[model samples]
Target: MRNTRSVRTHEPSFHQSALMDLRRGGKFAAVFLVLVFGAMGLFLVAALVIAKQSIPDRPAIASPPAEGVGSAPPSGSAAAATGQDHRREQLVRFLTAAAHPGQPAWRTWMPAKADTSSAFVYTPLSPADPGAREAGPGATARVRPSALTPAQTASMLEAVTRRGSVRPSSVAVSHASGRASGWTLDFVVRTSGGNWLEGRAAGSDRASGETVLSQLTYRR
Candidate 1:
């Protein structure tokens, strides 16, 4: 009797080997593409960080006012007040010198160095009587050194005797209107008779912004 069981033979075929190789190649290509995309993403992130660090901060500028509106600049009143105060102090010094008999007090009221040709006008009055003649340029150079008359000398001496030393604390300064640019200084001194001697000094601080004495008058 013939054997009815059939025996299977094992063998490698080119078609099956080619199919297995193709599957392995496809898996490797997928892995390589994934790695390439991941590296590209990392490089992009790094480049963005470097660019951010290279930029510098900038300062903010103020915006200008709208059209037709104006921005207020710094006021000159403060500077004017300061200049007036300084001039007041100078006038006080002049008054102090005038209290003496022979000192050229008129010179003190003038600028240390005058740069202008404007004539200075100085007028000295007496406390004894209003009829006393005013002394200054064109009338008499009594404001100069050794130019005081016997009566004027006596009047100054009597005033000093009646009034104590000048008090710079009582000096005051005011602005003069109707002039282009000028100021008025008011001076006060305490008297032994408990009275107050008043003096007014008016002048133009003009001539390239130089302080000068143009007019000075004193009364009791």
Candidate 2:
């Protein structure tokens, strides 16, 4: 009798089959999750890029101007004119004060070094009293026949007592001819005696560089 080898068929058990199915299902779930998350990340990146390109650029802002940039100082001629106007105004005030009644007022306008030898000539334009004889154009009165100082002139003027007040009007000032720093003024004043007085005054600088009255004459 020939020896017959028994051929046994090997088969997997139920537990092993169940374990293999579980492992295959787990791998399929992991692959699906990875694909979904990767697609979502790509979509987010594309959306950000498109948004950046659609936005408009902002405009630049300008700065303010510096201090004192637009304004300029006065020119030389303008400054000179302003100085001349101021000097003229000062002279007017001085003339007004000099004609006023009191000795104190006269001193306020007179400079400290005023010429002691200054001359004052007066011509009558109208008589103090209507009945009195009117002086002719050529006739004049030298209030101070001798060379009198400003103080002496003021005292002499004060001595001629008059009833009404004195005030200046129709004043005109001009630059002296051929003299750079000289000025001449012409003015009319209503005297304390109810008569009109016309006056001319010229100013010059002294040796000590001080401006003082060189000539002062009046017509009444």
Candidate 3:
């Protein structure tokens, strides 16, 4: 063979190196995509846990009041009793202030103060005489307050809620000038029960002329 040189059928070293570098680059891209997605998933899980911990918990509300509502009395001494206990329950159990009223029906009354040490007095709706009972049958008893403390007066006033179909027609409290003491409180408790049952109570400390005026008007 006359001097014909066989051409080298081989790539340059630089070209071969470039081909190897391309292959490695493809693997690196795939691994980079996986690592990027995995980092995003971890960040999302961390965010969810932080949000869950941010919320605060609270307690529940209380239920409603009872039917008769035996709460603390506002004036004198609050008492708790049912409406049906008018006749049977001792009226004395409800006595509080000065006197239960009796009268020609005054329109207003001033009740005793929260600070006074005055004694409570009882004034029956009807007379203690048996004749008074004879006039009204089933109206067997009328026990007003004979004596009462502050709480006792509140108890008596609470009794107004008793009796069938009872409603407070008008309840008023007032105080007036007394001869000896500073003032006298008059509680004018007027109620309706198919008829009017008006009871009154007055009270005084060491003051004379302090008493309640009670009046009950029954209409047939």
The candidate maximizing TM-score is 1
Better of 1 and 2 by lDDT: 1
List the candidates' TM-scores in order: 0.40, 0.35, 0.24
Model 2 spans > 4 angstroms off: 1-84, 99-101, 108-166, 174-180, 187-198, 205-211
lDDT scores for all predictions? Answer: 0.56, 0.52, 0.39
Model 2 clashing residue pairs (backbone):
125-220
Of 1 and 2, which scores higher on TM-score? 1
| Model 3 per-residue lDDT tens digits across residues 1-220 | 6898889887669988999999999999999999999999999999999998987766677778788675655442221112112211222222322133232111122334442433233322344322234446434323333334444333334333343234433443332334222323333444343444444332222324223233232322
Instruction: For candidate 2, write residues 1-220 as lDDT tens digits.
Output: 9999999898889999999999999999999999999999999999999999999888777677688865777787765565455444544555565555454554433444444455333443334322113334445444322344554455444322222244434344443232326666565556656666556665654455444544455644
Clash tally for model 1: 1
Weakest 10 consecutive residues of candidate 2 by summed lDDT: 124-133
lDDT of 1 by residue, 70-130 (tens): 6565367755666666677766665566566455554444544433444434433343421
After superposition, which runs of candidate 1 have C-alpha atoms over 4 Å from their true positions?
A: 1-74, 110-131, 134-165, 174-181, 186-189, 206-210, 218-220
